[model samples]
Target chain A: MSDFIEKFSSISLNDIKNVPESDFPELTAEEKALASQAVTYSNRIEDADSISNLNDSLRNKTFIVGNKPSKADLLVFEKVFKVASKWSSVEDVSKHRHIIRWVDLIQNTLVNVPESEKLKVSLDIEVPREIKE
Target chain B: MVVTLTVAAKAPLVPYGSLIATEFVNRSNGDGKIDLQVVDQKSVDSADANSASKLTTSDGKEIKGEADVLKELGKLFPDVLQEVSKSQDLIDTAQNNLSIKNFKELATHLEKLDAHLNFRSFMLFHKCTVADIAVWGVLRANALMGSIIKNEVYVNVSRWYNFLAADERFDAAIQNFTKSLAELKKSEKLSKGKKESHKA
Candidate 1:
């Protein structure tokens, strides 16, 4: 029973989704897209252009690359927070209102994230409480 | 100037308290990066130990105290706590204890540290902290300690002190202070010899 738990525990949701469709029929194409998008954006988290793109995508969404919280959001937030945490200037943060809202939601929602694991973004850009069309 | 250097590089933070990477640290000690122009307010009485060292910040703010100087320098870094190494509270006590000129109190400080050294290898931890550096720096600058520390009065302190003195990190700062003092003494002797020749 312990051996079964250890084997399954090591296999995260990300690993299951990444295997070939034949190996795992439960893996949906949309979930694959979400995880892939997270990897792509996380790789370029340093580029300002990628930050703006992330801003646009996160306008109506709560998380970065998924409908709800998952490893996808965790992946991007870990990288993006390191970059966005440095955006202290009014002009810098205000340029991407969506990012501020998303960063705020992600940071406030995540409970177990240790300070050493990821940096917390600290800026006041007057972001609206709710997203408006 | 970027403050809070590894006490590892410089043997002791000079008498002014902490290493400020000042231009005044002679050519050999000046690392170019941390060097800043320090206007040393030449106190009238050179023997006056109570006079506080002062630093004029880039913003024209006056900062005093060795601990405060280190923290102010730490603020220059993105993460102050990460940059400034631990046991500042320990260093603070060392700074105050060493600054006491009275022989009775000075011995007490030495005795306390000697006792503490009995329990741990270093001042506060298994490894060297700024407390060790700060205390060592203060002792290094005091002429009386040079003679007193030579004898095994505080055996634990002498052992720990010798260990720190051997480290190459503290060598640069130690050499800087020692060299400057030697130069000053040499120049004084030369001037005295000239005066005697003129009289003869």
Candidate 2:
């Protein structure tokens, strides 16, 4: 099954509809629209302003929803990471400090050595260039 | 004055209606002058109907559409009347500017809203006004703009959107919408099943 369907299979429809917590409210209608927009927008074109705006908004934030990395934060992190990676001329992520901090915290601190090490093999990812140097 | 608003749960304008009702209730704060009743049309209609979106006054005058209902509320209350009009204008501009075909126009409108929201927490000076309600409602209702807010595409606008969204009143309103929509969908599925059985 699709990633979406697999996720859906685990949750009840009632669970799907309700924004059950103080954490991330179930994706509101607007969030759904934004998701569609984000997917479509990314498929067709890249918007640098979107990346910059996300980075600007995250200036003081530790995570997207809370201090810890939630699924919402990870989803946003992945999307913004895609945009940040596309900035051709920037030698490193110095300009996008918030994003780098978030990604590092998730990969190095949140995920344990084995998991991150496995991710490294699959993703072939290095510490963000700034952190590496 | 008791004002009951009947709103279609699936309508794109539903969020605005909910926000208006929530804001009105908050502003009233059990003063007993303004008793706001919000009715979901999903229970009454087999299918969602925009015409069911109306506001009935205590005197029994039915007002229709987001603009009309908001306008009447402004007339009756007169407290946030100017703010209501300003909010509607901002909503109109934001709604009009959302276009997949025209990225430049969308960016321009986004920047304009971002700048407008830069220093202001609410659309108005300090308090959350109808302008914030209408714009946030409309933006949230729009799928693309909703994503923009969800993703925090514009820093100031995202900050402001998150603030209003965090309001318990807003959360309650959204919960009601979610329940009503789910119920409507369930009913729709059952009805479809009945039809299929009859055909079989």
Candidate 3:
């Protein structure tokens, strides 16, 4: 139980935001415009399709860029769960086969962050301690 | 599909969402189009100020900055300012308001936002979609903001941001925004340096 709690506790959302911006340099105006369009289209599609399935699928799947799960997976997974818990519509969609498979995969594969390593990362000060408690 | 686009600006700061929305509309080739509606609040305010100095209100009251404008513009034009204010509110409430100390934490927040946006469903539905474009745009903007700010405490946000930044689709956009931001920062520094040198 402590291990599970620690693993969950160790996962911080802020880590997800910083990694990429640091790696990529600046973009051109045209590129920025295109990227913005791409993201907008992506959201529209999600809204049009099975929002529930999308949310559930996201929760279940590990965001493994290559073979192994990266911090990306953790970043996405946490939000998916948060939203799922928040919205009833999304929770209902979690019943889908693909959604279930994806969530299970994340929980089974990526839930293990060693206790010692977990201690090293700082908890977000803004996050209510009572939530973890 | 017929797409309508609008570009609205209030003042010094362009609402990040509006900026991203405009960028998205511009990027969408023929699939959908945007009609930009630029509401210059600064100009409107200035006009109001000028009018206030000229005459008293019909209600026997002195005009003021926002009040004069509201009185003269009626309900329609004032709505634009209301929208802008709402956007500003979102910015104020943005979760990543804190200056992050660790890169990992930033990455986490970015990823969480990304997931909340739900890009995969967009990909699943339409080959080229607005959601994809919007998410990518916001993510790129966030990346640039994070870089400029230099507080990488949000590991998840940073990691997710990096993932998109490295992707081929976003590579160009990320680079472009970053370059512009970097150039702006450089010019700012150069000007500051020149000012110091002048003082010396």
Candidate 4:
């Protein structure tokens, strides 16, 4: 699995809360910086031109990370594809054919191979160890 | 056609569903041309399961992803293409701007949005387009930044926001989501209390 997929798998829904502070996993300084950059990249998605530019840039690539759809593709897709329909038109999609192809691949595979099915098959969530007195 | 849109009440992307529902309602004008029903999935997991954009068409075609649904909608209403497409840019900008963790950066975005709203009631033309719905829905769905909106941080955006808040369609779209979220939180607290009592 890719680094993001591993890290994201470690995080449970409990880690996400309305209130800021929570028992999230410890991250290295580099990971923290990457998180910040992700936020910036997420923000940039609001601009159609910026997204179009990104799509154009990624036209040659099969996915954002590796040939297969990784958590990286999912993350970016959540931000871009989630809101693309509400804002983007046919023209925009035609302009960014690569993005559409990438989005379709993820959406299709994700539906066919549901995450719940994966969790059912694997014991990914760790149990808490007993505390030492 | 009957379209069912399911979403988590508090999901960050909730606004997308709400905005689309708002547009459908406004354009339909009780003509029954489109029947869009917004369903709130209380649990976060259930919401995330089909979070993209879960739209079941009249013919039982389950379509996921925000882009896919909008494309379908655009095909039905060709005039909405330009407005919806333009609104995507504004919505994207708002999502990024709203994610600004630093106050300084947030203020800069607020100023820009305020200026955009200056002397304008809606984001695009004189009428309420998908752009207005998208921007308004984003800010409204986000309670943290929603404070800025409620506090009237940006004069023009606030004014425009208030105008939409009073709209029947806008209010109608949010009424159920707000109520469902509150109920979900209440049940969560109850369940937490039960767990604590069991431990005690």
| Candidate with the greatest TM-score versus the true structure | 2
| Winning model by DockQ | 3
Model 3 stretches with alpha carbons more than 4 Å out: A1-133, B1-12, B22-31, B35-152, B166-200
Error of 3 at B58 (Å): 34
Scored by TM against the true chain B, the candidates give 0.63, 0.73, 0.32, 0.69
Per-residue C-alpha lDDT of model 2 across residues B1-200, encoded as one tens digit per residue: 66776666655445464444545565544542444444545322344344435667888887766656665666666553346655667645644564333556676777767655432334654355566666766666666676666666676577667766666556666776677667777776787886664674
Global local distance difference test of model 3: 0.35
User: How would you encode candidate 3's per-residue C-alpha lDDT over B5-111 as one tens digit per residue?
Assistant: 22223333222333333343345343433333344343323544222111123344433322222222222222211233223322322323322334566545544
- Ranked by TM-score, the better of candidates 1 and 3 is 1
Residue lDDT tens for model 1, A1-133: 1011112222222343343423221325786686677669778878877888887666434444333344555556666766776776656665665565555544544323444643344332243222122
Interface RMSD of each: 26.2, 16.1, 14.6, 22.4
Please tell me how candidate 4 rates in CAPRI terms. incorrect
Each model's lDDT comes to: 0.50, 0.50, 0.35, 0.51
Model 2 Cα lDDT, one tens digit per residue, A1-133: 0012112212221232342323333565555554444444334325566655555545434445422223444345444544554433333444555554444444443222233332211121222221111
lDDT string for model 4 (B1-200, tens) is 44665455545456454444534555553533444444445323453453544556678877654444554554445443336666677756765575465677777787777655432435764355656655675566555567676665664566567656655566766776566567777776787886664674
Report lDDT (Cα) of residue B9, candidate 1: 19
Ten contiguous residues minimizing lDDT sum, candidate 2 chain B? B43-52
Order by lDDT, highest first:
4, 2, 1, 3
Q: Model 4 TM-score?
A: 0.46
Across residues A32-82, which tens digit of lDDT does each residue of candidate 4 receive? 544445435756887776676656534434445322233454456556655
DockQ of prediction 3 = 0.04
